[model samples]
Target: MMISDLPADLLDEILSRVPATSLIRLRSTCKQWYNLFKDQMFAEKHLRNVPKQLRVLTLKENRLFLPSVDLNFVPPSIEFSDELSLNNSNNSEEVHIDSAFHCDGLLLCTTRDELVVWNPCLGETMWIKHSEGSKRVKERKPMYALGYENNQSCRSYKILMFWDCDELYDGQVDGFKVYDFNSNAWRVVNYPNCFIMNSHGVNLKGNGYWNAYDDNYVDYILSFHFTGERFIRLCLPPPSQGCMYTSLSVVREELSVLRCVKGSSKIEMWVTTNKMDTSASELSWSKSFTMNFGFPVLVYTGLLIDEDKKVVLCNTIVGDHLRGACTIGEEDKYYSEIAFEGMSLSQPPHIFNYVPSLVRIQEGTELDVFGKSPRRRGDDPPTRRGDTAMCDHDFQFSQEIDDMMS
Candidate 1:
């Protein structure tokens, strides 16, 4: 029997096991295979068949480097030779990526002028321009986040952008918008909170959460549900007076906060045990553990947590360099440094737990949705280096703190 004559179910089962990179090339063979590969059911099944691994993406010298992590066997230092650089032309203006956030397999990189959604695996990119209202508001910088929503019938990826407007109250913000990949259009949305902290939003499942505060200095968790296109406010643990720094992260699928308590050398980590319930009191914060670096000057930012190994990955400022450390279980309380050969630690890199996949940003839409031809592998546009260097204006930490640690 011919391959095209095979049963539909059997064909789907066979194609689901194929790797995403290869599927990109195979889709051109025929219209039937192309549609099957882009089907929601086929994509879900293909994702399940792919292995999940943790990798770190960092930027240095105007390029991106990705390195794999294995908790069981820690490496002295990670060395990355593979660089993901922009392929622009020598004549065109160079693009500077100020900050980046990862969701599923795609990365949302922000430049001064535009937002670029890039897929390193598929070598594809889509550029988006900021709204006209946002461009008019020059006081506050724009906030960007990449997230996905999945239901029984559809799976959608979206980009959210918002900025504070001076016309509103002190904490109030304006120019909130969302871009749907399927529609290739931007829609204005209501801004529920007064202000969102200038940090990357942590995405869990299909929702994104950020640490936000109001004019009264009251802190709360600002959550955005992608599927519903609505915002929900969740309460934070009562603030501890004189805390040095507090940051939010996603640990083992739960919302977690790392706070350095006042008048103490200990750093406390609290994880939300119950997140589904909307009540502020119902959302419980269970103390995961306390870390005392045994040095009065030590401060850390929680990066990722390996629950299975009982180890937490963190970045600590020591002297003039930023170092990576693994904090072991409570009883043992062991900390080990991750060794690396190149790259300066002066700037703390934005780190995220990345799982590579074959997910496409524009699967269900037509090729001309953006009024541009579809980009395939090896069709990258030429990139040129700009005269001026790009600075990390959105770097979360303050220079004063780094100076104090140094």
Candidate 2:
């Protein structure tokens, strides 16, 4: 029998094993196949069966880029090979992505005036306009985290938006809001006071994690659980007095952290010893590896680790006007640079992992909680912010970057 002649159950099983990239092209093969891809149950099964390929993604000047890294080389190499198309509709103007957060296969991106959930693999976009109350703090540009519940019955995606108290200006207080996909509305939530170091959070399983400091200035791994709508404080990889910079990333489906010592010129890698779903008290870490760079390295953005190859790739400012990705190898004190041309000196490029999947985005309708309509496609865009100076919340980070150079 031909492949297309197979039974529905057999075909579904076979197709679920195919990689997500290939399924994108096969969606048009038949009406049955197209509808199968839209089924929420099928999407979950496909994600589980398909092997996940984690690759580095960089955003430059509001455009998304995929970097191709080959580890077979003696020192490893990286190049910009592909760009994910963000313009899918009739509008020719490209939206300026002010910030982006990734969870599962969907990207929660924000322009100056609009918030959208985008699936690059499926080329689907869901635009969610801000509520009227959110406009009061529009100038502050609140940080966002996209996550889902860990329930087995069904998955509910949510976007957590909050302004860091330190980022507040003119004596403004912080605000917290959660955008529920089911209700298509934003609801307020109470949270504790903590300074989240990065605007973009590290997503693992169905929760969001960030390197943060409590009111006491003691650093710890801060997590926001979507199911419970609460913040939990977890221990870090032990405290180090020489630790100048600490960043978070996910590697091989596990949470990993990179700690850069100020004067020692050494960086240590740590990974969670057990699954994060366990109790916060039971969470722990084990040192993966360490490398020495002759100069003090600052890794506040993030880093990609190749445990098998013993190499780490991180983004850095090469000179006054150039930004590049430095590849540090085993037993090699020096790093090789792959400088990115035409990079903006004012805004340093941010690096994170992107996993392509078939997650579907449900676009919000015209009606909102307040029964008011949001900005339409033809509406004029909001005024843009002109200044490029780092925000006041990042004052200590700026000082540390300067100390590294001095």
TM-score of each: 0.70, 0.82
Compose the digit string of candidate 2's lDDT tens values, residues 321-392.
555777775557335668777867556677787777877754345464556543233111113332122122
Output the number of the TM-score-best candidate: 2
- Scored by lDDT, model 1 comes in at 0.59
Q: Candidate 1, 19: how far from true, in Å?
A: 7.7
Q: What C-alpha lDDT, on a 0 to 100 scale, does residue 268 get in candidate 1? A: 70
lDDT of each: 0.59, 0.67
Model 1 over residues 1-406: C-alpha lDDT tens digits?
Answer: 9989999989888877765544554544565765676566677688767544445555544456554334444332334454456544233354566667777667887765667777655455666655442243456667678887776765688888777445444646666788887767778887663564634577777678777776666677788878778888777766678654455677655778766665565777778888542233335677777777655433434554456545555555555655454443343434555643364653355555555455666553344335653343323222322211111111111221122212
TM-score of 2: 0.82
Model 1 CA deviation exceeding 4 Å by range = 1-37, 48-51, 59-62, 68-82, 89-95, 131-137, 164-173, 237-245, 275-282, 296-301, 317-334, 337-347, 364-406
Best by lDDT: 2
